[model samples]
Target chain A: MPAANGNNAGILKSGHDARLLSRSNKCGNTSGLAPGYVQTNLIVLPSRYASDFRLLCARNTVPCPLVAESATPGHWGKIKSHLLGIDGETLAKGLDIRRDAPKYNVYVDGKLHRQDCEDIVTEWTDDHVAFLIGCSFSFETALADAGLTPTHTARGRNVPMYRTTLPLCAAGVFRDSTYVVSMRSYPASEVERVRDITRPFASTHGEPVAWGWDALERLGIRDIDSPQWGDAPLAKIDGKPLSSFKNNEAEVPVFWGCGVTPQEAVMRANLEGVVMAHSPGHMILLDTLDVETIRKF
Target chain B: MPAANGNNAGILKSGHDARLLSRSNKCGNTSGLAPGYVQTNLIVLPSRYASDFRLLCARNTVPCPLVAESATPGHWGKIKSHLLGIDGETLAKGLDIRRDAPKYNVYVDGKLHRQDCEDIVTEWTDDHVAFLIGCSFSFETALADAGLTPTHTARGRNVPMYRTTLPLCAAGVFRDSTYVVSMRSYPASEVERVRDITRPFASTHGEPVAWGWDALERLGIRDIDSPQWGDAPLAKIDGKPLSSFKNNEAEVPVFWGCGVTPQEAVMRANLEGVVMAHSPGHMILLDTLDVETIRKF
Candidate 1:
C-alpha cells in the first residue's frame, strides 16, 4: 500500500486513474476514492443461479438495480450498460474483474469462506457469470454536488449499513431474505431537498427508502451506531467521541437501499458450491460518469 | 353515439369522466379526448410468447417501455407500475381491459383481420396476457403546457405514423420487424424547446428520436402527408391545399418512437394464434396524471 500521508490522499482523478491505482494496491475500502464515476457492486455466481438472480433483481429493483452482466458464462471481456441511449462510454475494457476491485468476499455454502481477498483468478471457472450491480456510490456525486455531504464522508469512514424487515420478492432457489440499507445523517431541514436531489438517479437506488429515526426503527434497525456491513460510524474526528455531533438534534438519519441487500440474499441462498461478491465498500468503477446514470428529466 | 356538437367537444374533464364517456360512445379516435391522463397502447398475446416479448421490451426500452403487464395469463385485476417509488396513483383498478379502449384491432397470421371493433370480451381467453405499453400521448400534455402544441392535435386529426427501416432488437420468434414512428411538426426554432419539455417522460418514448424533414426521408419516407397508420396529415386546414403551410420555412417534422413499433413487431412474429391491439387512434386511459410519468430530476 502507498504511504499513509503522501500525494495519493484517498481520492483519485478519474475512473481510469482509480482503476490503475486499484490494480496495484492491497485490498482496501473504495468509498470516497473515485468521484464522479459509476462504481458497481460485483456478484459472481454459477450459470445455474444466474436466471434466478436476474429475476430477483427485476422483482426488487430498488435494492438491486441491475447494471451489466456477463454476456455468457466465463465471458467477461466486455458488458453493455442496461440503460439505453445514453451518450457516453458504456463499456469498461481491458481490465481483470478478478483484481479490479480493492477487495472481494468468497462465500461457500452460505458462510464466509474468505474475506478481503486481493484477487480470485484461481477460483474462477467457465461456469462463473459476473454481474455488475449498480452501487449507491454512483449517485454520491449528485449528493455532494447538492452540498448535502454524507456524514460518513465527512468523517472519512465507510457508510453505515443495516439489515431491515423489508422482505424481498423471491425467485426460484433464492427465497426468504429481508432488505438492507445504508444510512446517511444530514441536517433535518435538508431531507426533502436530499430526496429531490437524488430522485433522478433511478439507475442507482434513486430516493431515500426511509428518512427519520422512527422510520429506521420501524424497518427493524435497532441501533444507529452499529452497522451490519462496512465500518461503524466514526464518533470522533481527532481523538474524542463525537459527543456534540451525536447529540445534534438538527441531524436526521436517511436510508437508501444498500448493495449489501443482494450480497446478503446470495449468501442466504447457500448454494451447493461458492459465489463471489465485492467486499463491503470495495466496488467496480465504470468509465461512465455518475450524471450519465441519472434519468433524463 | 353521443352528438358531436354537444357539451362534450372532444375533451373530457378527468379520467373517470373520460371512461364514462368512452363506455357510452361508439368506437372513435381518442386523440385530444382526455386532456391530462396517461393513455396506453394495448397488446395481448399468448403466455407462450410472454417471456420473449418481455425481453424484447427490456432490451429496446426506447421503443417499448413496458408500463404494466397482466400478472398471470388473462388475470388483469391490478398491475404495479414498473416505475419505482413515485408517489402517485401507480395502480389501474377495477376496469375491464377488453372493452375499455375506444376502438380495437384484431390480427391473425400477421395480417389485419379486423379494424375499429367496439369490444372483444367474447374472444378473451385464459391463455392470453395483456401488455399496457406507454403511449406518446402521455407526453403531449407537457408539450402543450410549454406552449408547443402538436400539429395533429391542433388540426384535430390522428398523428401521422410511418413504418421505418430502423430494425428492432430481435427476441425469440419476434424478429425481422422494422420500427414505426409518429411525426409532429413544430416551428424549426422550437425543436430544442420541444425536446427539453418531453425529455422527462422516459416511460413514454422519451424525446424525439429524430428532428428534421431530411430525417423523415432518410428513414425511407417518400410522402410526409401520407402515413401508414392513422389519418393523413390535413395540409389544408381552412381553405386551399396547404401549399402555404407546406412552404412555411419555419416548420419542421419531429419523429418519436410510436407505440406502433411494438404492435408491428408482434404482428411480424405471426404466432399461430389471434392477437389484440388498440385501434390506430384509440388508447386506454389510466388514472394517473401526465406529469406523474415524468422521470423526476
Candidate 2:
C-alpha cells in the first residue's frame, strides 16, 4: 500500500489510514485502501479441503479465480506470483494480513464471531492453506477510468453486495449459493464499452451477467431508497435515473460478480475452526503489474 | 477428417480429393483441405519423450501449442483436441502419415531419411505418442477477415515459411534452435491492426516476432525471390512487397510459435524410427471453431 500521511492525501490517505486503523483493530473493513493497487478477497483452508476448493475455483473461475495458491500446504507465508522472477517475498511484509485488515471475522463450526487479526494466530495450523481471489478494485478502477463513478467509492462507503439466486457450481463441500454481486448504475450508451473492457479482466469478474432496471425487481430487491450495503446513488443526471448502459441504451442497473462470492463459499463450506481472508479493501500487492497478469490469461 | 465427395461437393470434393490423393501416394500436402476448419501439424514420439515434449510445448507454447496430446502412449487413435472438440481418429484413416504428404522426410539417429507415412507406421510401437499442434490456418482467416489480402492465399500457393535465427526455449533433451515461420505481407498502415487482431489467437502463432524486408535479409537470405518453403509474393501492392502483415513495422519480423517447431524438436531428439506429422497442409479437421477457441484464451 502507498504511504498515506505526508505528500499523499485524500484517496491515498484513505488507504494509509485504513492500514493504520486495521493494524490497531479500529477499521476492519478494507473498503478503502491503496487507490491503485488491487485488493483481493482471501480464503484459507486446510490441505484436506484444498483439492475441493481448487475444484470450486476451477468450476466458478469467474467468481473465484485462483490468482495465487500457496505453493505447498501449511506455508501461508509463501504466495507465488504467477509472473516469473517474483516470488519468495511474503505478502505479509508490507501489509500484515492479520493486523492490517480493518476487521477479522472468525468462523468456528460455521458460526461467525468478530475477532482481531492478532487473536487468530493461534488458530493458524500446518494443515491450513490460503487462497487470494481477485477483487473488484480493478473493475472499479476501470469503471472510474471510463468516467462512470461507483456510488460506493464516491461516498466512501462499502460497495453494496447482495447474495443472488444464481447458484455457483459446487465443488466437494465448498458449495456456494448463486453469486453475491456489486451493483453500479451507468448510462445506457456506456454499457457496451464497460462490457468490452471487463471481458478481458475475466479473472476479475469478466462481463456483466445481467443489465437492466428490472434486474433489481427480478432479484426481489424491493427498496431502492435504502441499500443493504452502501448509500443509494445521488440524484439522477437529467430525467433518467442513473443507469448502466446496455446495448447503447441506458440500463437501470448493471450487476457484476463480486469478491464476496468466494467468501460466502468459504463460509458455506462449514470448515472447522477458522478460515482467514483479507478484510475487503486490503490486498497483497503483487510484484507484477495487472497488464502482465492479464497477458498470462 | 470429414468425409468428402458428398452433396457439399464444392467444398467436400476438394477434401475428398485430398483424402483420395493420400491413399495413392499422390495427396502432396494437406494444407488446403476443408479451407475454413483448423489444420494441425503433427509430431510423434515415444512415451519416454512425452514428458520432455510436453515441457517443450509449455515453455514455448506460441509455436508448439499442445492442442492435443495422446492420453496414453502408443494410443495414436485416441487423440483429443485441446481447443477443439475434435476426437482422435486414426492418422491413417483418410491420410497415410508416410506417403500422403507431398514430401515426407524421415530422420533416424538425428539424420534425415525421406519416407512415406506408411513406411513409418510399421515401426510404430505401443511406446510411441502423437501430438497434434495448432497451425496458421486460423491466422490466415484473421488476416482475411481484416480485409488484408494474403498474396500467397490469393495466388493459390502456400504461405512462405522460413527457418529463422530466433532460438526457441529448450526443454530436457530438446535443444534450442531458430524458429521456422510462415510469411504473408501487407502495407505498413495495416500492420498495427493485423498485429492487434492476431495477438489474441495465441494458439495459432499469435503475433509476428519480426517485420520489415531488411530483417528477412538479416536472417541470411539474399534473394526475396528464393523463398525457403513456399512461393514468393505474386506482386507488390501499392509500393509495398506482399509480405507477412503479421510482422510489425518494427525491424524485427513477427514470428509466431509454429506447430512445426515441436515437430522439429521431436526430430532433433532422434529417439528412433519414423515420426509422422500432418502431410504439411493436410490437417485433421477439428469440431472446434477458431472463434470458440479464441474465447477460451
Candidate 3:
C-alpha cells in the first residue's frame, strides 16, 4: 500500500495509467482515479454460466446493467461491440482483462480464495468468460459534477453498502440472488436534484431506488449505524472509525443499485469452477464514454 | 369496412374504444387512435418457442423491445410487474388478449393464412404464449407534438415500410430474420429536431436507424418507389395509389424499427405449429405510460 496519504493521486488519468499501477502491484484501491471516464465491475466465469448470466442481466436491467461481454470463453482481450450506448464507439480498443484491473478477487468453489491479487494470470483457464458491468461510480462522477457531493466522498471514506431484501429476477442456476445497494447521504431538500442528475445515466445505476429514514426499512435494512461494508452512516461520533474529519451534514440517505450485485450473485451460485471479479472499490477504467453525457438526453 | 372519409376518426379515445371497434369489425387500423396512450405489437406462439423468443428480444433490443409477456401459455391475464419503465403501473389493469388488438394475422406453417380476423377465441390453445412489443407509432405522436408532422400521415396513407439487409442478432430458432423499418419523411433542416424529439422514447423504437439518400442503399433497399408494405416514398407521382393531397412538401425519409420485425422472423422460422401477430397497422392500446416522457432522461 502507499503511505497513509495518497501517494498516487491526481496522476491516474486513463485505463493505461490504472493498468500500469495494478501491473506494478503498487495501487491500493482505485477510488477517485480517472475521474471523468467510465469504470466497470468485472466478472469472469466459466462458459457454462454465460447463457444464464446473459438472461439474468437482461431480465433485471436496473441493478445488473450489462455493458459488454467476451465473444468467446478465455478470450479476455475483446468484447462484442453491441451498438447500444457507448459499446459501439468504445470496444474497438482492447486490453488484457487479467492485468487491466487494479486487483482481482478470485472465488474458488463459491468461496473467496484471495482478494486484491493484482493480476489473475494463473487462476484464468480456457473456459473463463469476462463480463464488464456498468458501475454506479460513472454516475457518482455525475453527482459530484452536479454539486450534490456525496457524504462519504467528503469524509474520504468508501460509500456504505448493504445487501437488501429487494430480490432480483433470477435465471437458470443463478436463482438465489438479491439486490445490493450503495448509499450516499444528502439533505432532504436536495433529493430531487440528486435524483435528476443520476437518472440520466441509465447504463449506470440511474436513479435512487429509495431515500429518507423509512427507505432502509422498506428495503429491509435492519441497522443504519452498521453497514455491511464501508464506513458507518454520518452521525454523532461515539468513538467510531470515520478516518477523522467531523461536522458532516448530509442527512437524507439515497440508495442506488450497486455494481457488486452481479459479483454477489455469481458468488452465491457457488459453481464448481473458478470465478473472478475486481476487488470492491477497485475498477477498470475505459477510454471512451464521457461521464457527463453517457446516457444524458 | 369504414368509409373513405374515416367513419370512426375521432371516436378512438382509449383501449376500450379500439377494442370495441375491432370487436364489431368496424375499425380499419389503429394508427392515430387513442392518441396519448401506449400501443403495442402483438405476437403469439407455441410454448416451445417462448424461451428462444425471450433470448432474441434480450439480445436484439433495438428492433425487438419487449413490453410485457404472458404469465402462462394461453393465459394473457397479466404480465410480470418488472419495476422498470411502466410494467408495474400498467399490468394491474388487464384485458382479454384474444380481443384487444384491432386485427390478428394467422400464420400457418410460416405462411400468412388470414389477415384482419376480429377475434381469436377459437384459436386460443393452452400451448400458445403471447409477447407484446413496443411500436414506433408512439413516437409519431411525439413528432407531431413537436411540429414535425410525418409525410405519410398528412397524405392519408400508412407509413411506408421496407425490408432491410440489416441483420438482427439471432437466438435459437430465429435465424433468418432481417430488420423491417417503418418510414416517415421530414425535411433536411428539421432532421436534428425530429431526432431530438423522438430519441427519448426508447421503448418506442427510440430514434431513426438511418436517414438521408444513401441510407436506403446502405440497407440494400434498391427501389425507393417500391416498398414491400405500406405507401410508396414521398415523390412526384405520375399515376400511383395515394389519397388526394398534392402539396406534400416533406422531402427527407427517416427510418425507425418497424413492429413487423418479430412477425417476419417468426414466420421465417417455419415452425410446425401456428403463429399469430397483429396486422401491420393495427395495435393494442394500453392503460398506462405517458408517451411524452417514456425515456426522456
Candidate 4:
C-alpha cells in the first residue's frame, strides 16, 4: 500500500503501488501524486453510447482528447490496460477502487448524488464502458516547471472554473454544451511562454482556447466575487495588496480546458445505468510518464 | 489534370483535374502540385512481410512513418482513404495506380531494374499491401514560409544525403542499416530558428538528427567529393574555402532523415515482387494541409 501524501514527490516514491493504492482507497486526492506522470479523467458508459461518445471526443478533442478506447465489450481489464496499462493478473490482484477516492460524486439523471466508492460498484452493470480523458494537471506541472507558478497551485485553490460560450460538438445523446475552463493568474509577459510550452502537451488540453483581461466579462462573468470551485486567488504585489490602492504589477488571469467536459457529457446523457470516474483530485496513477505517454502513440 | 507548376496558383488553376493529371503522368513531379497539401511516399509489400514492415516503420518513424495500414486484406482503397482522407467513392471513381507517378522504380531481390510505372498493376498481388509515409517537400515549403530557405533548394540541387553511423532501431528484416540523412548548411545565427521551425514537421522527418561540419566525416563519410545524390554545394567564397574564409562568421551543417530510408528498406528486404514509390520528386498529393498534418497529434 502507498502512503496517501498528496504531493508529486510522495506519488513518485509509490510507483506502481500508487495505482494499487488509488484502486484500494489507501491513497487520497491525486492532486500532487505521481509527479510528471499523466493523470486522466474517467468516464464509463454503456456500450450502446460508446460510438457517439467516441465521436464526441473526436470532435471536441481539445476538451475531451481520446487517448485510447476499450478494445471489446465486457473486457474491463483490457480497457483498463489500454488506459492504465494494467494487465489481467494485475486486475485479478484486486484493487479497492471505492475507498481510494477521498470523495466520489454520483450522477443520476443529470443530478448529482453523493456516493462513496462502495455505492458506485453496486451500480455497475455488465454493459458499462469507460473512457479516460486528458486533464490540465499535467500541463499545469509543465507551467510550474517553466518557472511560472499557477495561482491556484500556489494558493492551494481548486482552480477557478467557468462555463464558457464555446459550444462543444453534439454527438448522439451528448448535446452541445459550453466548454468549462479553469483560470489561473500569471504575469502578462509569461502568457506567450505558457502558450508555447502548453502547445506540445496536446493530450493535456494543449493551448488555451482564449486569453484576454476581459475574457471573463465577455463570458458574462461579473464581479469575480463568487467562484464555482476552489478559493479565489488573492491579487497581490510583493506578498501584499495595498490597503487602499490598486497594484499595477499584479498577476493576470489565464484559462485552460478543465477535465470536466466528458464528465459533464456523461451527466447530461442521463443514462439509466452506472458511470465510473476518479473522485475529485483522485487519479489512477499509471506507470507511464507524461512524456512517454505522449510519445508512445 | 493538375499543372505541374509548384504553388497555389497552379493548384487553383488545375482543380480536380489535378488528381487525373497526377495519374496521367502529365505532371512530371508532384513536388509543386496542390500547394499546402501533403505529399506522401508510397511503399508496398506482400502481407507475409507486412507485420515486419509495420514494426520497421514504428521503429524508424523519422524515416519510415507508418501513416496508414490496410484496414483488411484486399482493401487497398480503404488504406488510401484513411491516409489521404479520400472516400471509397473517390477511389473507385478511378485512380490509375499504374502510370500515376511520373516515374516508378521497380525493385526485385534488392536491386533496381529500371524506372517505370507499368509494373505496378501487374505487380499487385492479393496479399500485397501499401504504406504512405511523409516526404520532405512539405517541411521544405514550411521552412520557406518561415523565411528559412534550404540551401539545396536555393542552389537547385537535391538535398545532400549521406548514410550516417547512426543505426536506426531494427524491426524484422530491417536491421543494421545506417540512417540516411539530408544535409543543409545554415549560419550559426539561424540554427535555433531553423530548429524551431522544423521541429513541428515531425511527419516530415521532424528536426535534424544531428548537427556539425565534421560530424559526417566522423561517421566514416570522409570524402566530401563524389557526391551521393545532389550536386555539391559551393564550398568556397571568392576563391577561399567558405567555412574558413567567413572571418568571424560560423556556418553549421544540419541533417534531416531522408525519405530514401523506406525505399532502401524495401530494397534490402529482397522480397521477390513489385514495390511502388513516388518518383524522386513525384509524390501523392493528399487533401490534408501541411499545418494540420504537423499539428500536435
| lDDT (10s digit) by residue, model 1, range B1-297 | 322213344567666555555666553667766677888888988788887687667545667888888767886555546765642234465656787787788887667888888776866789888888888988887888787877667666667798976555445566667768888877778877887677667778866766666666446777776789976765433422222355464666778888888888998788878889988667888777778777642
- Cα lDDT tens digits for candidate 4, A165-235: 55454555676365677776666677677776776666677667555565565444443435555455555
Q: Per-prediction TM-score of chain B?
A: 0.89, 0.77, 0.88, 0.81
Query: Candidate 3 chain B: minimum summed lDDT over ten consecutive residues — where?
Result: B238-247
Provide the interface RMSD of candidate 2 in angstroms, 1 decimal place.
18.2
lDDT of every predicted structure (CA atoms)? 0.72, 0.57, 0.71, 0.59
- State the lDDT of candidate 3 residue by residue for B1-297, as single tens digits: 332225465646576666666667777777777676777889999999887687666545657778778876778666653225555336436577787777898877777788788877778788888888888878777787777767666656677889987655455567647889887766667766776676666666666767666566666787767789887856423334322222233455667777788888888889767888888888877775545336422
Q: Report model 3's chain A TM-score.
A: 0.88
- Scored by lDDT, model 4 comes in at 0.59
Tens digit of lDDT per residue, candidate 2, span A133-198?
A: 777666666667777767556655555566665556444566435667777666667766766566
Q: What does DockQ give for each predicted structure?
A: 0.02, 0.02, 0.02, 0.02
Q: Single out the weakest 10-residue window by summed lDDT for candidate 2 chain B.
A: B1-10
Report the poorest 10 consecutive residues by lDDT, candidate 3 chain A: A236-245
lDDT of 3 by residue, A23-86 (tens): 6777766666766667788999898888768766764566787877786888777776432554
Clash count for candidate 1 is: 0
Pairing residues by index, what is the TM-score of model 1? 0.52
TM-score of each: 0.52, 0.48, 0.53, 0.49
Query: What DockQ does model 3 achieve?
Result: 0.02
